[model samples]
Target: MKTILAILAGATLALAATAAPAQTLKSVKDRGELLCGVSKGLQGFSAPDASGKWTGFDVDVCRALAAAIFNDPNKVSFVPLTADERFPALKDGKIDVLSRNSTWTLEREAKLGLLFTAINYYDGQGFLVRDARKVTSALELDKSKVCVQAGTTAESTTKDYFAANSMALELVTLPTSGDLVKAYEDGKCDTITTDVSQLYALRLTMAKPADHIVLPDVISKEPLGPVVRQGDDQWFNLVKWTIFAMINAEELGVATNTLDAAVKSQKPEVKRLVGTEGNYGEQLGVSNDFVVRIVKAVGNYGESFERNVGAASKLGIPRGINQLWSMGGILYAPPVR
Candidate 1:
C-alpha cells in the first residue's frame, strides 16, 4: 500500500508540474496578445520605429510564434527588457519566451534552469573604436579601457581575451548597452566590446558613423537565441519548431513570393514544413498550417535576416555563419518529419 501511494503521489506531482499557464494556447488566443521579452532598443534586432510598430529580427520570432498559436502575427505585445532582466522575466512567467540576443551558455542552461530553443544569430565578440584611433588589431589595445555591459557574454569574453595574452586593460562595466555606448562616447573607455553584429548596430547611434571601425578579430562564439523556462516541454517544442520551420522553409525554397507554388509540390520536406504532409501543427496545439502562417506572415529565416540586418539594411550584417548549410554556413534544420 505504501509503495502504491508513493507512485500515485509522484504521478500527481508530474501532472501538476506540466499544468503551468502557458499550456493553454487558448488563453493566449483569448487574450489576443502574446507578451514577448526583447531588447529595449537594438536597431535591426528588436526596436520600434517612430510609428510604434515593433520591427527587427527578434520581432519576427515573436510574430512567427504568435502567428503559429493565434493565427495573427500582430497579436503580440513587446516587453522591453535589459540584459539582466531577460532570464528573470522569462523564469517568472512574465513573458512567454525571451527573444533578446541572449547567448546560450552552459552556466545559464544548467544553473538557471532554462533552455535555448534555436540560434537566430551565430556571432562573436569584437571591439569597435574610433576610426581616428587607427588601431587595427585588438592585440594592440594593451592598456586601453573597454566599455562592457555587466552580466553579459562581453564581460567574460573581454576577461578571457585579456588574460589569454597577458594583456593589461582597464574594464568599465556598464549597466546596459545604452550605458555602454554612452560611456564609450564619453571617453570613459577607449573601446566598447560586444558581439560583432551588435558592434555594427551600435555604430549607427554614433554622431559620425564613419568615425568608428569594428575590429576584424572575433574573440568568442556567440550563438544567440530565444530561451524558455525549463519544464514546459510543449511550449519549448512550439518555440523550437517554429524556428525550424522558418529555416526549413528557406531551404525548401518556400518564400512568400513563391509560397503558393511551393505549397503545391509533393516534396516531403516542403510538405512537412508547410503543414501539407502531416498534422505537425495539431501536435503543437496550433493550427494545421502553423508553419505556413509563419512563412507567409513574417517570412522565412533568410528573408527576415535580409530585411533587418543584411546588406540592404543600415546594419548590413553579412550572413556569414548564419547562412544555411547548403550555402556553406552552419545553419541547418533537422528533418521536419
Candidate 2:
C-alpha cells in the first residue's frame, strides 16, 4: 500500500509539471488582453504616435496575436521597455510576449531561459556615421568612438568586430536607445552602431537625417524576432504560428484588402488557412478562423512590412533578405496543411 501511494504521488507531480506551462494561454484569455513588451520608442519598429497610440512593426505582431485569440486586434496593452528591462519583464510574467527589436542569440535562449519565436526581421549589425566623415565602410571607422545601447548584443558585437579587425574602439554604452541617440547627436561619439534596419530609424531622429549615412559593412547577422518565456510550449507555439500565418498568408497572395477574396479562394492552402478546410488553428488551441482574424486585423506579413518598415514607411528600407523566397529573398514559411 505504501509503495502504491508513492507511485501515485509521483505520477500526480509529473502531471502537474506538464500542466503548469500550459497556463499562459488560459491566463491570457482570463485577463482579456495580451500584454506585449516593446521598445520605448524605435520609430518604424515600435513607437507611440502623437496621440499616445502605439504603431509600428512590433506593435502589429502583438495586435495580430490578440486578433487570433480574441478576434479583436486592439485587445493588447503595449508595455514599453528599455533594453535592460525587456527580458526581466517577460520572465516575470509582466508581459506575455516580447515584441521588441531583440536579437536571437544562443546565450539569450540557453542562459536566460527565453525562447525566440521566429525571425520576424532579418537584420545585420552596421555603423551609422556622419556623412561629413566620408566613411563608407565599417573598416574606415578604426579608433572611432561608437555609441551603443547597454545590455544589447550590439555592444559585444562592436567590441568583437573592432578587436578582431585589429582596430581600436571606444564604446559609449547608454542604458537606452534614446540615450544612445542623444550621445551620438551631441558629438559624444563619432559613430553609432546597431542593426542596419535600426540605423535608418535612428537616422530619422537626428537633427539632419540626410547628413548621416549607414555604412556598407554588415559585421554580424542579427536575426531580430519576438520572444517568450521558455517552458510554455503551448504559448510558444501560438506566437510562432502567428508569425508563420502572416508569412504564409503573404506567400498565398493574401492581404488586408484581399481577405474577402481569400475567404472564397478555391486553393487548398487558402481553404486550410481561411478555415474552410482542416482546423489548423483549433489544433493550436485557437479558433479555426484564427488566420482570418489575423489577416483582417494586421494584413499579411508583406503588407505589415511595407506599411511599417518597408518602402511605404519613412524608413524606406528595401526588402532584401526579408522578401519572400519565391521573390529572390529567403522569407519562407511552412505550409498550413
lDDT of each: 0.89, 0.93
Which predicted model would earn the best TM-score?
2
lDDT of 1: 0.89
Model 2 poorest ten-residue lDDT run: 17-26
- lDDT by residue for model 1 (61-156), tens: 999999998788988999999988989988887888899998999999999989999887898999999889789999988999999988797997
Runs with alpha carbons beyond 4 Å of true place in candidate 1: 1-26
